[model samples]
Target: MTTITHRLPQKRHLVTDLPGPRSAELTERRRSSVPTAVGSAAPVYAVDADGGIIVDVDGNSLIDLASGIAVTGVGASNPAVAEAVATQAHHFTHTCFMVSPYEGYVAVAEKLNEITPGDHDKRTALFNSGAEAVENAIKIARLATGRSAVVAFDHAYHGRTNLTMALTAKSIPYKHNFGPFAPEVYRMPMSYPFRDDTGVDGVAAAERAIGMIDKQITADSLAAVIVEPIQGEGGFIVPAPGFLPTLAAWCRENGVVFIADEVQSGFCRTGDWFACEHEGVIPDLITMAKGIAGGMPLSAVTGRTELMEAVHPGGLGGTYGGNPVACAAALAAIEQMSSLDLNARARQIGEIALAALSSAAESLADQGHGVIGEVRGRGAMVAVELVKPGTTEPDPELAKAAAAHAFSRGVVVLTCGTYGNILRLLPPLVIDDDLLREALDIVIEAQTPA
Candidate 1:
């Protein structure tokens, strides 16, 4: 029989073993110098990626279910992305949007304002990463409201910075020895339906959190209450249905800026443009990054024009905030997302994942396997937490095992959650159905008894 080759936008060429020879060499080189903690995720040796497949240094290709930590949604190596990048690179790269502005940067901000959730007169400020976007959100809120206190939630994963670390939930890995973190950042209990006590009903979890901030954090001096509609790294944990709107309502009443950290959940990764739109709640400020620039480094804080304008001149920019190439890539990425209907595609992907994940979890339960206890998330940002089963206790060791097992089978998966027991998937939206199913099957096969 002859082989028929189809030119897939995403390429997969398993020329050598997983991690291949060159990848192993690079890993060894890094192990000698880089910190041990940073070497955990897939050994970081991919040389190229396109659409949904990542190719390693030694010519090994694996399905990239972890889309650069949920960054590249339009697809890896997209023609639009590449063309935009190349065109911008040819025409001068950086002028520091602050020192001298450019059309590309202004256009990107305009696009964000028009597309981001919230119909009010919105504005945007670009930055280098999600962390910086979040930092600016705090600054804008403080300057606008004349308040110093900021409120976050338990089990939330905002970013990795002085202020953001204080906003984040975990400490051992992201925050340990990195603090004394920024002050006046208070954490309220998030409404984790999976583990919430009856003291706060699922539907009223937002009210409960608001009460905490009101009673404990003191809204009198509060600048903002920031939240991820679907908590990302703390686990792909979706808040209860009414939680966001209720929280937003309280913020409105108390004059606290409602900041939505949509870095991980925005740009069609969720069913909507922004996760906050799931409940028709328009936040005072929204921070975004990750999937914005087709894998390029870019982020933005979009919000009410009045609030954004509150920040004085020369207070909100970076040397590389809106790099022209990155801005061009982002414009192309947004166009691609809208043209391809990736938002709807993301919802469909979630449906596919939900059915397969539930069935696989049930099979594992029947077989008495001690991994994959629960599946939860919205759209393509789905997760399954590994556990000992029939208990609330987390099983990080089993999660690590499942991740390694998936990598061994030519699939790249990432693990998150405060306990580090949740395995999450973030395949590019352009991935073909067969490839997605293939990756899911690989994950299933990895869980079977050996």
Candidate 2:
């Protein structure tokens, strides 16, 4: 197939093996300098990336379906975002918001407040990462409500920080041996419609969870209830239809601050500015990162004015909470997203990918090797869970093999899920339709049994 011409040419071309000689050499050098703990699925050294392609040092072009873990919604090297970063770097790089406030910081905060769900008076606090934003959100909630316990759902991946680690439910790589973690965080059942054998609806899921919370944790003792609108690292699990709204309503009635951790699903990745908007669920606070700055390190906690104001001025800031360059990039990224209407593009991508994947799954199922257990997601964030042919048992080996096969064919795919049986696709929102379809085809072909 001919490569589509773009910034880096949206195409997949294998000049050599998957981790060609150049990448292998770099990997050897990296082993000596970088920690073994920091791992990556795509074992290649990227020299240039743009649109939907990541070019390695060996001249291999790989279709990017992961989008740098959903960071580059506009694109990996979006012209506007790159220009903004370079321009800001030329003027000034640091000058942290707490040390010397800049217009860029305030402007980005304003944009976040305006775009996040709800028109009620809200405030924004910038942070360096999703973990920091989540930690601060808990701090604010605890202070405002004078409560100790916070509720997090199962199959949740908040972050890796101490508090977030406590909130996260994974055990192997994320939370394993990282304890003793932060205290007073409780875990509850999530509304995973796909895995729910009882066939519970959205409202039923919410009621079941609320019953547990009421029985275990008293209303006045809880500080907040935090959840991902669409659980990202936890298999891209999308809660049932009415689950989020029901939970948000319960939180409001009980005065527990409701927080939507949109780190992975925000910024038009899930067809909406924020995933919570899909169900009209208005949270007291929203934690954002990943796609906020077009791949730059920036995050935020935007919330109701009253809850935010409850925190003292000096109580909620870090040294580099809102670096000038990052804030500038965020402003440009938001402008680019709005101008390009990336939200609609995300929805379009979802429609095409979902239909194709559903059809493929059905065909494979008829063949008696029904590996795809479920295909779920919204917008550009989609996933295919691999399971045993005749049972619901997770097949991590099959998922791993499919991802490896796609990578060998010059398509970058990411595997995730608590059981490591999910293949997630998060192509850049600005990806060309042809390239997107081509990448999806490669993945589907890889999953087919020999």
Candidate 3:
């Protein structure tokens, strides 16, 4: 397949005030028609997006650093993905893989099995969302191990489904009143270097969590230990070095299935095919989504063949799982990743972003504006934590203000973290270097207080 370049000028341009007239009208319509529960980062409504730029309804072009929350790593409206979806839709939109299997579904499964970590024989089951993939992975673990308990980490985000909500660490928007929550799920302390008051290294931190698990939810009764290799919505928290390897090793010793939730960190988003690769940890079950299908709604649970096959036939599937159009998009996206060497591109983006953010953080600290706590992440996934000046106390207000400032200036950035004090950048791996630098400059300016 030939590479298709973005057509829009790769620069940010503002034609009207942030929302403009059209977007403001739509926002009003949304107030009455759509629920207030569904929130959007940008006030403007997007009409077209490609490469690293989003064109809003009033033709205001905004630099896209959020990547649709890391869904469009190859770029939103990727021509190759669009072509694949069009061709597949023309042939047949959906027969429901359960009713009548198609090559596209099987092809996606085959590709997932080949790409996900581990050389051991593996199998993949598809789903419609990351939550669905995570839910199924838990089901498979429970059935295979005949255990009832599961372990999750503090500040980890699995998904929003019942089981996943229970797995998720945050409580406000995700689990506040929504849950009586699923039982048999336990949370352990994560190895957060920035917030670790104990000052433990990766291996020691792993021991702390392991000790808690052994005492609280004994390994024998644990079905699986699920964690995001790099926690996404929980603030792009990359675990300390040796942390993942230690946890995986303990899981192996105890016979508990180890699951890596790579939903936001998979498919070359983190400089590797999966974030787990950075730590050299092979999970028994790996859940994937987001970048898998180039913005299509598709997710997968890929794992050891023995564990996956243990489930009875017809035990795993859904109505829209692996839709043909989505599968075709996945195939095209994977091909694009390999052919374009997006993994290397992600590394390049990471280097540039890390250097810029780190410098900004240092400069801010020198200027006595210590609100920029720490800048951390890998590959194209980067973030800056905000804290009160001269203290470790979280400053969520500062984060919100910075993001709003960026949006006002025609750049699309996002905020995350349990305390809501992290400004994250997830620009498309295919973004132009100059455009990325310009967007980062805006972000840095936003971080600086007047």
Candidate 4:
């Protein structure tokens, strides 16, 4: 793989305290301007970023482990993506594909069709966000199958949109009091090995979910079953082996559309182009975003040609879906992922991060600071779930404390999960080995009990 040289210094440097004077002023201003509901994990305001480092306004260089919630996998300021965006903007910004159309949008669709799982004839539709892609995927499935009910799994987080809010499981924050959500969405048990009280293996757990569908909402009423191969906001839970394959097979037998929500785990983030490839489970439809366009806002839903064609031409579209500049960025980002062999790079990162985190968890347990319930996740998208020392009870306070600790020490870490007890690490795929190890050391220190 070719080495990626970042413009900024790769190491973390604290020139001033986190949320320094400049950031504090911005925070004060933001409190009055922006709504309180839109929370920010890091208090510092970023001036620039590249590779695995984010430079704040106060001249603090912090290690970036969150990758802007799994976007920018190629890097925050990849030269190719930036150049493409600039070139596209120079030519023309938005002609609105629905109006005049352009080659960039077609090219992006072609690339998505080629890269997404399944060799079958496929079609692609671009959107502005992951939630939009998911919503459109569900719309296509319903129209194609002539069914109303859609099934989502436990601990799943689709998005914040009203329809997606109903699909999401957690009550607090994401779905709290935001009721009268779209109907016909059903929740089923997921194959979460760590939290499974039944102690069932992958196949049995899938059977349990299938049984629920059989009893409550039969297959005939179910239009599609959407799932994240690796649950993202839900603690980076990788379902036990055979779980995804069993569900996909069942969906096929029942004529229900199977949609893989790869919004968080797609684009070589999980040591594969998509996490479903890990299990060889090809979905009829797949939703992607996050890392698709470097840091540009772009999302897509790629699916079987027939299923996608079911929607009338005018039925699926938005004003800014597949904006020209974003498509250009996506094309360049995909090329970067291919030429740099980021899939292999992600595997290497996984090995390093998992080993370090696992060792830390063991050390903490031996020292009787056993808040880490489980260290899990694949590739660069890794996390450790925190729990009460002796029991499986969640310890969200510890997760928050650890994240705060990391931030204070010049590392940016993110916490997610229904209970907000999992510390997730999503470093850029191009992060240098030395820099990654240094960041991991700081993360280890932050996770340690004080």
lDDT of each: 0.86, 0.92, 0.93, 0.94
Which candidate number maximizes lDDT?
Answer: 4
After superposing candidate 3 on the true structure, give the runs of residues whose Cα lies further than 4 Å from its correct spot: 1-4
TM-score for each model: 0.95, 0.98, 0.99, 0.99
Listed per model in order, the count of residue pairs whose N, CA or C atoms clash below 3 Å is 0, 0, 0, 0
lDDT of prediction 3: 0.93
lDDT of 2 by residue, 1-450 (tens): 112245776777888998999999999999999999999999999999999999999999999999899999888888888999999999999886787888998899899989999999999999999999999999999999999999999999999999999999999899899899999998999998889857699999989989998989988899999999999989999999999999999999999999999999999999899999999999999999999999999999999999999988799988888988899889999998898888989999999999999999999999997999999899999999999997889999999999999999999999999899999999988889988899999999999987
Q: What's model 4's overall lDDT?
A: 0.94
Candidate 2 positional error at 274, Å: 0.4
Candidate 4, residues 1-450, lDDT tens digits: the string is 588878988988998988899999999999999999999999999999999999999999999999999998999999999999999999999988899999999999999999999899999999999999999999999999999999999999999999898888888889888898999999999998988866698999999999999999999999999999999998899999999999999999999999999999999999999999998999999999999999999999999999999999799888899999999999999999999999999999999999998999899999998888999989989998999897799999989998999899999999999899999999999999888999889888987866
Model 4 TM-score is 0.99
If ranked by lDDT, best first, what sequence of candidates would result? 4, 3, 2, 1
Alpha-carbon runs more than 4 Å astray in model 2: 1-5
Kindly report which residue stretches of model 4 are placed more than 4 angstroms away from their true locations once superposed: none
List pairs with backbone clashes in candidate 2.
none
lDDT (0-100) at residue 412 of candidate 1? 93
For candidate 3, give the lDDT of residue 197: 65
Cα RMSD, each candidate: 3.0, 2.0, 1.3, 0.9
> Residue 19 in model 4: shift from native, Å?
1.2
Lowest summed lDDT window (length 10), candidate 1: 1-10
